[model samples]
Target: MFVTNVERREERKGPPAGGRALDLLGKMERNEREYDETIAYALALASAWSYADPQALHDVMNSLGFENRCYAVTLSNDAVSARTSASLLQHVDGSAAILCFRGTEPASTGARLADTGVEPARLHAWKAVQGGVHSGREPMARYIACRLKRAMNGQSIVDEKGELVSVDAPACSDATGEPLEHRLKALYITGHGLGGALAALAAAMIFEDKEHEGIRDVVRGVYTYGQPRIGNEIFARRCQDTYGRLLFRHIHANDLVPMFPPPSIGTFEQFGHELRSSAAGWVFSEQPARRADTAPFGSTVDVLAWVKQRLPLVRRLQRPFSSDEHAPHRYVSVSQRSLRLRRSELGLSLGRLRG
Candidate 1:
């Protein structure tokens, strides 16, 4: 029932008081050209805002009807990231900016920008990726934890040491007195599957806490990879019922994390309704899973090489004949009563396939 083919259902609903917003979003999704145009407009606005005078930028945003204080905050964060990557926010207003930079040497570019009078109100700097202290709050850490737990459980995990244990445990402090150990948390589990499950569990715990207080709308974002767990669905539905805003789950198609084998109810489809309504939902961006040569065993080598090395024996597994050749045997194996029940329940025409 969860995987029903119907495009619309009464049980599925949008945020209260946001009917117009939902309509606009739905229209955008239905028209790919319009959707892309909107994105281009947003990007252009961002680009123009970056070069406009601070006051002019403010006026432009205000004229566009984006008056929410939170919108400004989100925009500021986006601006900061943009500036770091492509100078897209270089000339934007810096009076209210909170700049957080991650890289080795803290990138002299930021310092030069400050020297040039592009003073950010707040700045926090750290080494990029695996260079600095490991924070358990990050998705990569959660992934490592999941794999470690699976390995400890006697599952065949590949590149366990390379992926999970490659980083040295924190041993020193920066110029600031913050201890590296305090910055990183040890992972409690292992594997992308379990990592996704752990993220759902974390979200569920937060939802439950908010529920106990009779408070909703306390959460703003929930980012996770791969398929959804049963607990995730329960929590997500509850969040929607109580607060109306749904969680955002990101899944790269080629990663195979979001779509595991066997058709079943998944978090991706469950949240698809919400994504269809969100302002910037369901962005099918490129994820470096296969491109980066990442594998189930957590190796960074070429995907084919890693697979061949780790699962060489699987190459000998028998291959199935074409679906057309196998169809008759598959149908003959089904019980008459079961077929009748399926036909009655789903209105399917198996005879069409036979024909």
Candidate 2:
């Protein structure tokens, strides 16, 4: 049966279309050693493309032989919060899943406001979670976690006819028609900007859920691009303790969104490894750089202050092109290029070993 808010169409089905998704998934299947970087870059590309068009993403997944394995869900906008959208893509063997959240929409005033709002919120769903998270993101993260749990549990939803309908897609089940919890191994979460922040928090929410104990460990990784700080130091510590090297936050060249809701305004902080984009490729760091003397300041105000103090004339003449820095296209382009180079390097290393 179809999921309550999730849309899964079955009208058009065909063989794998051999697109980027198929190519990347093929690489994973062919070489286990490359899975980590390949999957991360694949998710990064998917996250950036999701903001432009969700349907295109569905089509891409379908071409990658996902077919009925793809589902898109959208939570309606309320007076208080803007609409939130997410998509789930499952591997054909039920071995892995990717949950991608749509980033902030430019046309939505509510989303724009949420990006700027620095308020803290402690969600009841998070149980005894140590600290508060971005008020704007908590609810959306909770919603996403709940839906993912339902999909994994193969829970049913009531249709308009007042009948219980199984919401499990073929990807979530085995040939015996049973839920594939055993086969369901790895789960990857990803998004860009506000969506990235939600992806990070949703992983935390899933872990905090006792009911999700069966599936929480399946959360293999959380890959976020240009995401603002989602929670405070305590929350960050808990996440770092739980995910460790599995958590990756990618910051494209000078992305302004990632440096937001300054620590001065709230206790917010970023945890996990940082993948700062460079001309050479992605440079990995233990944590994000925040000091004024370092690159990638903690907030927009810090950026302005740095510019004003060091080069007032340049600051006045050329205002920070913050939006361009945060653009989804930039993330997509850089990630794809980096992935290519990574593959080339690995190939050369293999050749040397063979020699």
Candidate 3:
């Protein structure tokens, strides 16, 4: 059944009249199944580009309960380059940090290139990573890692132009005079769409590269929405074995992006736990939905056929395009509804046990 405009509005607004706004940071648990709503909602908001302004990103994050949080740091290859864009925000209490990557933007040539370059490339002699990975995301991942290393070391973060960028507050010392790394409790990585793919790759780099080992223990988790398959079987297995439990991939129903570069092509695979959002609630699955065979290297005939197959469903939804389902707002809507439903169920279960 198609969702009506009213339902979509309700999903975006949250809580019928005045129960309470969904708590953005309350009841946060390290475990996968519990206390995920906050992470899901926060990360979904974190994915948006929102003018690519550090101040704007900081304002959005502040609204999500990051009290007195340090200013956000925006990263790109250069001042005028659109090759990469990501934001880093550290909590005021120094308990956590969030690195959010910008999803693909239609106006961005760099984003378009990153989205299309999904072919696997081997990286055997790299400092830490050693296997086949997405060609487009690898370099960006390394760049992020390098910058993060500098930030953790208390050095000023700089863009490619070598302009000074803020990593945390100017003082670089907490209330207790401890270093940023010493006070940091956890690091959370997130993104949407293509950004999600980059988030996964970044996490892999942190896990495999010894240079980042210092902050590895503080990596709380990776939360992503509508991310596509990023690496080959060997790379997938390595990450899955190492920090699979820390990766939470959320896919809303029929989001076409996650289904791309199908497993049939080049041994590409998605690893880690997947939470599929639907009207019923969030469905947990270890296996991804298998898509129809898509010929390698963007075969025009096969690609057209695939698009044609989903056209009917897309039309029924009244979407502007078939890819509309992959929009960040769509994921946000689904996550809000699923979280409310799950919370309601948990309340009822608790009530029954009490009775």
Candidate 4:
């Protein structure tokens, strides 16, 4: 059946009415049994890119229909340092470019760093995007964000065999002589574990429309697996307002990494679509409907009332912090199943899907 305009609006937002949760589950296919394979390939590619080996990461990018692969590396280890590795790839079709962050690596100190950075619910001002800051949101894991920021600024690219790479080329300029924010039609960011948290924060930054730089109007989606909370309440709401269902958290049974920096310990929260694997198959859960006016906020007047409303949610999101369920391949397996549907049939525009 054709979805009416009002229905689509209601699906993305919510019924023009009251909501109890964060209004995540908008309009989803109720009886749909199949998933989109193309999305699976893209996600699989992202999972592979998380590895540190350049040659291996390069090979994975090629398999996923991407070219002009670039790798992001971070060297700082202090509160102001960036430690994780990320990569960039322009889709072979030239429809989109992707920023993929590698999740927590074995014996990596960054994997255990306590969340420290915090800021308001905004991106680094276009004019003040210095000091390696991406979003104003806190608990952003400063080290990780710093690394990614440096990688982006460097704009380094890797060759086919991952042999030739450089940061020597100057930045690109548009035909009109304006600086391009990024060259691809759209930007899609993804990661697992710590990378997932960084990816989420990065997604929030990419969609912000401030000033000066290439226009990244096409932020395709921020897809994450076993991702932990990345920001405070206000930041979460900002992401929800900006991306709606385009933000995805793919959870497998009992994955523990998603439970980090427990919501009870801080203002952290998840923002976007939530899909989980089940005994039968995989299932997607939109946040329960919520209204900004009614939802509990940090500024709420009654502390008792706010805790009463939020405690349950925090407990529900926490899982034991140990499990093989946190792996990336497991995420790809389930996401491929639940994300099935062609763009035309999904009622989404080709621009968002391809770009």
Candidate 1 lands at a TM-score of: 0.24
Residue runs of model 1 more than 4 Å from their true location after superposition: 1-193, 210-218, 232-236, 243-246, 260-269, 272-355
Q: Give the local distance difference test score of model 1.
A: 0.25
Q: Give lDDT tens digits, candidate 4, residues 170-226.
A: 332212222223434555677776666667766665566343133345555677777
Q: Rate the local accuracy (lDDT) of all candidates.
A: 0.25, 0.58, 0.59, 0.47
Q: lDDT for model 3, on a 0 to 1 scale?
A: 0.59
User: Residue 131 of candidate 2: its Cα lDDT?
Assistant: 27
For candidate 3, write residues 190-289 as lDDT tens digits.
8887778777888887887787788788777898887877776777888898888888898877665676654444666778889887676567876785
Off by over 4 Å in 2: 1-23, 26-35, 63-68, 106-113, 124-182, 291-321
Please, what is the TM-score per model? 0.24, 0.71, 0.72, 0.58
- In model 1, the clashing pairs are 145-189, 145-190, 146-189, 146-190, 146-191, 147-190, 147-191, 148-190, 149-190
lDDT of 2 by residue, 296-321 (tens): 33244344645664775765544332
Model 4 ranges off by over 4 Å = 1-37, 78-82, 92-94, 106-183, 212-214, 279-281, 287-321, 336-355
Give lDDT: candidate 1, residue 30. Answer: 39
Lowest summed-lDDT stretch of 10 residues in model 3? Answer: 168-177
- Alpha-carbon runs more than 4 Å astray in model 3: 1-23, 29-35, 49-52, 68-82, 106-114, 125-182, 262-265, 295-322, 353-355
Cα lDDT of candidate 4 equals: 0.47
